[model samples]
Target: MTVHTGAPRWWRATTGIAVPCLVAAACGVMLWSSAAPVVDFVYFMLAGWALVLLGIAWLVLVVIGWFRYRTVRRTLLAPAVVAPAFVLVTAALVVVQAPFRLGFLVSKPALADAAADCTYSLEHRRIGVYSVRSTREFDGGCLFFTQGGLIDSVGIAYLPEGVPHLGAPRHDGDIGYDHIGGDWYRFVERF
Candidate 1:
């Protein structure tokens, strides 16, 4: 085996210690930032791609170091493996979580209002008539309105066959039709 003796002690120490630490720190920062609501989806996508590329490059460096330097191979190995793995995992998570976060970001205001109305109607049981037609964001459905203009219960159908339109009770006491694949309105609900 060929020995590499010209390398500086500081260089070996920095590569062995500092690089891995920096990579870990960067991964932590990326993970923490990705969870922030204010960050845009586009930013996440871009950052994810960038991290993936960086990981790939770091992996290449690790392979080259393994072949070229006997003394420093161990020094270069840990960061080379761990950094890329951490970065790739973080990138994947950020990409996967983007859609749900974007959905919340773009959710229609009408859905929020309808959900609030449904909650109030259900809790008070004084419903009269309540309904919300499905939008691109939320499923279309109707709720039963009791005598006191409060909602009694809610039923929503996901992606109904027809185009989305406002639906009201056909008659004063009508609770409206129930459909499948939709969620029942709840007081505290997530998107």
Candidate 2:
């Protein structure tokens, strides 16, 4: 059996802690700055910078440990672990956050108008019309919208004719989409 020892142990522990923190920091930067419609470029830049930092940290540790212990490289220097770990974490992050990010972008146009509707009548749960057309499947509470400052949420329950463009209302206590003239629209929590 092999075990991490001496500097290699410290190096591995430090990298393990830092890698997650760097990833989380990158996600934070992306979410916080991504509200702007034009923030895609900036978000990419921030992500790239974060990746560079991660790579630098990893490389520095590998090189230092490789020169110091020599045996460390044989055990820890596996591209299979590094590459697959990176891909898995990245995929997980994207899959988890894609809905919220897409929802934010889609609703940005209606934000101002939605905010305005909240002041005069705040008693109503219904906001306004919402439209959704997706090539991907959505569950209950998938899409959210805001109108006149009022916010509402809906989701796609069914797709008739196997068409993503055509969705039907659901009774699962969630809003669904309707197809009208090849377009999807949600109105007042109904399709």
Write model 2 residue lDDT over 65-159, tens digit each, in one string.
Answer: 66665546543645314532663565465556553456444654453244333223223343222233221223311223322111233322222
| Residue 124 C-alpha lDDT in model 1 | 36
lDDT of 2 at 10: 63
lDDT of 1 by residue, 1-191 (tens): 66565545654555556555666666655554554322333444555566666556555555545555543556445644566666667668767855324433443244445545443232432111223222223334433221111233233322334323334445444434332213432111111
- Top model number, TM-score: 2
Reference-based lDDT, residue 41, model 1: 37
lDDT of 1: 0.43
- TM-score for each candidate, following the candidate numbering: 0.37, 0.39
After superposition on all CA atoms, what RMSD does each candidate show versus the true structure? 13.6, 12.7
Off by over 4 Å in 2: 1-5, 31-39, 70-88, 91-191
Model 1 bad stretches (over 4 Å): 1-39, 71-79, 95-191
Error of 2 at 189 (Å): 30
Please, what is the whole-model Cα lDDT of each candidate in the order they appear? Answer: 0.43, 0.43
